[model samples]
Target: MQARDTTALHTAAATQSPEPGKKRDTGVRGTGTQIALARSETPAEGTRHLTGSRILCADLPRTMARFTTGTLSENRAMLIATEVQDLGQEHRGWADEQLTLNPEDFAGESRKALGDRVRALVQEIEPVTALERIDDARSRRFLRLIPTGNMTMRLIGQNPAEHGVLMHQVLSDLADSKTAAGKGQGRTREQIRADEFCGLVTGEQNISPRVEIELVMTDRILFQAEAEPAYLQGYGTIPAAMARQLVRGRDMELKLMRWIRRTGALDLDPRPDLRDPGLPEPGAAH
Candidate 1:
């Protein structure tokens, strides 16, 4: 998974067991509010946040899995973020238990903090849902994209030339995803989308994605992008300049080009075994 530091306002479930130890701590921008010293409602004590494996559960009253108890209060808490979605963790809202949201102020927290880097995404972890529009559900159509650096490119059409574009978009999406999540295509599908992606990117440290790329491939590379042009996750179709950049000085036989389509499926098949090839050139890093 790539590192993703999206500005979000997450609401903890009131149904969750009181934070362990139930002690109070001061609240900051990223950290939860300081509980401020207090007594526990029960026998449990020394309750700190339980950083565990994330278990996504939409429409779940128990969005928070399990953490030992800390203390209890008269419902006094602090703001965590701007992603105030209903059951959904990514969809954000304003009014940090104080402020209200204006139409133009959508993604306000993330914009103020991470800006263009934090994309508004509603990924389907389980049930496949019909994608909706950012502004209004009236336009419930899904948009194709290719993520590059800070922004995303919209995949408008398809063609052979589009394939080159698609390849670029997918790579950008993958790269962004990797940088955000800390995992890559080398990992299983599930492992690639874990919460670690968010922890590594913006929330942890702000690193510029634009620089250079150097893939040290010791074997032949089967690089088939969208044959016509395909849509990326947060980004849209691929870009021509990026595609042109990928085929630098590699052997002609090592690269495979194809046409990608807008609604086309990807070929995630493994590359064929290559004969013993010399060490790949260690190119410059961006």
Candidate 2:
């Protein structure tokens, strides 16, 4: 329905242009269509959806039929569209037909397995195009950071498969070693890996500057055994026990302060005494 609406909007815009013989610009048409769709939050997201819709509708009728019939999800259909995008129209159609001939078979495959199957088919049908796509994708590798709502950020990196696998293996080995050494006590393997990653990236495994962080919690939660959670200013809420561990452990230095709030506003003196003894040694028990 989104694709059909977008196509209709494009045709309408093109036909209603001031100059009878001249068509509206492609960018203008796309912008108008995307705005009319209003299903995506950003222009990039809208463009991606539009591209997938166009490819599925125009080049992969069988896949589109499966998608419409609820056999394939939009994400899976988009995966198929992306895989065949580099192929010529004839080859793209052929790949689509081959993939969707048995809808049940195709739909039952896992997401990763489905992608691998499509890539395999593309390589078999058009090896040169597949290679070209690989080169194109390799050139677009990037690392990005996105801030999620709750005071946390997501770090995403796109690398070649070999490099990614190797990096994961190295992190896993480090985490396993720390676990075996009794230094990773009170932390999960994933948590240990995350600490290792931060240490390596920030050079904190070696000598590093003192870092200060703010932790907010009610006195009941901090002093008593209250079940309330604590908020770590930049990281988000953490369990009360974890917060207590952080304060009691060598990682953070805590100085008590009191604030009075009449309204729902919190104000802290800017120049309140500050102290940072130092963070705990890497792999040290909390």
Candidate 3:
């Protein structure tokens, strides 16, 4: 990776060569020296960038072995190196060994799928670190609402990967509906989803058809108006008020539902559901 970064630097230098009799810019691409410069320039963020770059630098030889011999494509090699770049040196060696020794594992696979596999291996190599990182990330979870001009806004939310996939499945179902496919309406599926999003959030349209949104909350949260939060399955956590309002004045049936975690294990106790005649929650109770 150092060589690759240096090659990039050299290519840029050549492209910007000075005219005759003009002094050229002298820039050193020494590995550690550049990392120090990077840190000084952007103290808060650069250290992380440089450290990641250093890992890739150390792993480049093995990456090139895969690249040069045609066992992995250039992109896949970089993807694997980047995914596990923060792993400990010993674990990184294990990752490299896996890549080289098990070429068939990632051969001819999609980049996204291959990246996932590589990351999973990294988790295997250092499960404790992986879990700590996951918890740290969950602590930083947030949702952003950005308003575009012309009265439109963008909504972005960060959640667990499982919740993300479940949310996508629901929106996709709505976006692909026949009703959403308004004849000669001239709206793209994305635009339809936008409209559907507005409708659903504003209580104008139902979130799902045939299926009801299951609401799971403690009795205290539901009946006593407690400040505690409620679980909304594919939607992750929601405010207790929202969950209460959804069930207020409605006939809801309480049922025992199984709660499953990302690891494919069920919770010890069966989850309690507050299901109205309306749509049941898309996925399992959170």
Worst 10 residues of 1 by lDDT: 1-10
What is candidate 2's lDDT per residue for 40-146, written digit by digit as tens?
45667676666677788889998888888888888898889887787889998999889967767864677877876786676666655554665576579899889
* Per-residue lDDT of model 1, residues 66-107, tens digit only: 111212111111112212232243332211212222323333
Candidate with the greatest lDDT versus the true structure = 2
Superior by TM-score: candidate 2 or candidate 3? 2
Instruction: Assess every candidate by TM-score.
Output: 0.17, 0.60, 0.54
**Alpha carbon lDDT at 141, candidate 1:** 33
Quality of model 3 by C-alpha lDDT: 0.57
- The residue-by-residue lDDT of candidate 3 on 113-133, one tens digit each, is 776667657655665566566
Task: Identify the superior model by TM-score, candidate 1 or candidate 3.
Answer: 3
In order, what lDDT does every prediction score? Answer: 0.28, 0.64, 0.57
Give the best candidate by TM-score.
2
Candidate 2: the clashing residue pairs are: none
What residue runs in model 1 are displaced by over 4 Å at the alpha carbon?
A: 1-84, 88-121, 124-267, 270-286
